[model samples]
Target: MLGIFGSARKTAAAMADTAYWQLIIDGVTSRLGPAEALCLPARGPSRNMWNWHSKRLHPYLPSLQEEFRRLAAYQAREAGYADPGQTRSMTAPGRGQFVVGDGAVPASPVRGPGSKTKSKKKHAREKKEPGSAESDGGSAATGGESPKVAEDEPQANPRRKDPGAGWHVEGGEEEDGGHRVFGPKFVLTSVRDDRPLSRIVLDVRYQRPGKGYGGEAALAVSMLMDAAARLPGLTGACWDGALREIHRDQLMKAGLLIVSPQHDGIAPRRIALVTGCPCGNRHDLWSKGGALREAESLDTGEIHLTPTTGSRLEPCGGRRHRWYLLTRLSCGNTHRERLDTTREDHRRGLNRTEHLRQHPPDTDSYIHCYRWRPDAESLNAQLDATLWNRRMIAYGAPQQTLVMLALAQNALTRHLHHRQAPSTTRQERAPP
Candidate 1:
């Protein structure tokens, strides 16, 4: 048992080697050719995997987990499963085990240190003893850690009550029926083909339910940006319900928006900078080519601004115009003034749900180019069945162990699929 464990550790260490990476790449090149682009499927844990103490001790575990993902994709591609433009279909007719009504992902909970709750008596006693040497300079003199703040900070969430664990949610509606998953979360992308292409780990993160979809989206977007850096033409992302309107706008603003059902909406109209105030009262207020003279949100604050191009200044409370924005019109007047947008700018854009309903990307012919997004649940099911049972066997940082588990799962499943294909085909031919 000791020898087996030691050997496993050594194997993990070798995963960081350049030669090992080249070997995997060489194998993939021989089998499938170079990888082009992919539709990534992201999955979070369904259960909790760590206590507050373990999380504190292994603060850097999440970073290590992300590194493992990059290595896994590189290795899988080398292993000949994730070649560019591979024709393998991940969701062929009988390939994925899809069930009714559970297509969407559920929400997960984040586990962090609980808020410090001290009794009223303790606070009173501390106040009365403020003059004590320990309360004054003892910590500094002894070089001890600073005293912890006792305020009742907000806890992770009341819904997440499990100790030594975090929550998990898949994408989609509330009826998705997801349970708690332990360990780290991973986003994977593989070629969509029947020959079983290699899967790449796009991103990984420590499950934080408190952040809701925000944290997960950030990590996934980061990975997408990295992949875009490597493959400039990379476009599109097939995600679950986690890709909300806010996330879509963020991706669009970053210039990475592509064809995805989740990203359906009328792209926001372009806005341009304007010079020369439309008030027609010659002044330097609009002449200065520096930053905009003033900026403020619409319908929120006391912004003395208007969209009308030119009007009698007397009736309008005799307000002196400072700056203005212009649009081309027959009157050559400023049609509108630019207003700063808040974080929740979706309200200002087209309705997302309606846009998707009218023109679904799934029905569109153009989207079939990037390969269908592999069912994330299929990978999750495989991981749960093979590796993440009731409890994880590997010890130490859960992130490191979970990452290795994911890589092994991806490798093993691809291998298993190949091994069973021949026998399954023979059985199909040998009908009764």
Candidate 2:
């Protein structure tokens, strides 16, 4: 009986399809007596035949389809197939599994040229579970022997050829081939935080040909000082000279500090001292022969000095001298004063002084006694009035201008909107 069962099992293995083998097993089981103990192979091999045998067994079609799916899933797990939906295993033999195609496993344990032995050793060592005494301790079972220590410890500094023969150092020179000096040597005491707060010294000179104080030098200095005072963020205004002359007092009165350059030891802070010009000669006056004509009628027979060649006069060093001061003013109310001074100068010299007085020169005659002709002022006013009339005419025609302007604006807006609007219905429908 056992031999019969063994023969049946061998015959079942020889069959190509599992359903046929299962049928044969069922027939043999039915033939044996009911009392005889009977055993059968698991349903897996029989179920595998469902895919191939289902059409023939049409009465059980749905049941066979379910069994076919179940058998395919089981085979997929056993063969390590990733996708159960696929009928065949990716690891099927003779399917180029050994070749190193894209994402395929390497043919050998070696990686590249120098990787074979190291990779094998690493893999073998890793295969053993961690904390395994035999691998970690290197076979302690062999009389509990200690591992041999390496003869020489690995040196961190490897020996290399000395190309310079001790004559060179690494990074000896910078990229620009300059030696770097490291030290805090000369302290920059003047400038702090990279800002240049430097002292600029200027020298100013005054020269006058006339004996009495001509006031030109004082006026020039006052003008320069006034300009400086109008400058923004000006800290100091000073003059470096003696205060003996009356003009020096005038300079002091005009908000300028008078200090002796010799006595003031550089003023500790940044100093800019202005002095008189080195050359004593003033600019040539009366060069056009006007002053000579004016002095011709003077009764004094004593020779009168005039710049023109026609006047019989001796050269006298009594001409007026001019000196320009250099100072800075605050940015507040001083700016208003500067503007007022400029306006006054323009009104007196530009409009009024062009017309000379018809009266004879006398001791009491003053430069400001003359007035500008009424026609001059009236002409300027007419010109202003004409300009106002033209402006009014232009403004009154604003309706026509506005209509033209509106048309232009509307056209431009339409053009811009057309350019920016959606080009196609599909593009408009696309996700924003």
Candidate 3:
């Protein structure tokens, strides 16, 4: 028994030494490529344990297989097989079982521990019946019944194209061509008074052209007409020169007076003329030039004559002289002379020079005036108040609001000067 143990130990030591040497050779080959002659270290656990009797041989077999696998992998890598560990099955030498090169053994196929005839008989019994569905055809047996059809197949409805159909179809053309007519709904509310004083509600339907309004002038005219129609007590509304030519007849028919500041004609009577003024530098005032000089009366041909200045004043060509009078009324402060020129030598050169010096009669800063129309002046004052109120609310600042208030007060004071009736009355009690 001792001799047998010693022999086993010697075999294990030889196998370990062989595996250790093979490992060192594989490492050297990896760095230096394959070579004919290889030298391995003489000192190692395997070499030292050669005389040791207690060493076992079973443990060394795994190390030997591992070294062989490393050598195989190195060879596979050099041969350009990217995956060195990939397996190819091979029949073990003189054995039914197979051995994997990377240290794996093939598993034996499972079989029943019975005679060949008995195994054949068992498999035959487990087989399906000859006339069953599996043997007859690939189709499964369903008691010979046919399959039912689905219900969602395409079908035509007579009213599919009709927009009034109860069901909504996406991307379908509407029956009314998807056109909407919006009635007048906007109301002008004054923020200062916190009241909606005027509203223009149109019963008419306006269509947006597939092509939009081409210019700002058209849009402004549309917005102005729309706004004016809603306001109460608005006898007439006027538009700028850009809109006058295009919408003249239409605006006049609608009871609106179209006045163009750029036009070289006077606006018709009772129609509010909106024209550019040299004084205001805006197209807000009734007209350009002088209103009084433009006015005509049945009793008096021209209400007021244009003061002859640099040249002979033309007949005004029947243009309404209202604008000239309005200009005088607007510039009443500057025109201090009374209407009666006989009592007061209104043609005094010094007075004219002083007037010209103080308020220059230049095109840029010319003074405009209007005949004192109580109703119109009152309405203008209200409009001014409303405008100031809007500015105050829009600012929403206490200081700005106070400033607007002060401005409104000043405007109201000036407006009162033109009023036929003063808001305050001065009376003295007799000898009180």
Q: Best by lDDT, which number? A: 1
- Our model 2 lands, by Cα RMSD against the true structure, at 45.8
TM-score, model 1 to reference: 0.40
lDDT of 3 by residue, 1-432 (tens): 111112323434544576755765675576566663255445334423442422343345445433433432332222223222433211111110110000000111111122123344334434858776644544475655333324333333333121111111111124523322211111111101111221111111111222255333444445444433433222223222333334433333343322223333433222122334446521222212322222224465644333322211111112121101112323232222211112132333122111111111222212111111122233324433443121111111222212222223222322332252334632211111
lDDT for each residue of candidate 1 in 1-432, tens digit (9 for 90 to 100): 111222233443443456654565555555556561122112211123223333453666656655655654443434443344543332221111111001211112233344345665446547856766656645647777546555644444555343424444554333656454433444444322344543444444443444745666665566555554443323335555455545544444443423344332343232333445465432211211111222224586653322222321110111221112233322355444322223333556533322321113443232443234444556555444434232333433353344333445444544554555666443211111
Q: How many collisions per candidate?
A: 35, 16, 23
How far does residue 79 in candidate 3 sit from its true spot (Å)?
99
Q: What are the lDDT figures for the candidates, one per model? A: 0.39, 0.25, 0.27
Give the per-residue lDDT of model 2 (tens digit) for 296-325: 224766523332221121111222212222
Residue 131's lDDT within candidate 2 is 81
Task: Write down the TM-score for model 2.
Answer: 0.13
Which candidate do you rate higher for lDDT, 2 or 3? 3
RMSD to the hidden true structure, all candidates: 19.3, 45.8, 46.2
Model 2: residues with Cα > 4 Å off, grouped in runs: 1-220, 232-236, 261-432
Query: Rank by TM-score, descending?
Result: 1, 3, 2
TM-scores for candidates 1 onward, in order: 0.40, 0.13, 0.17
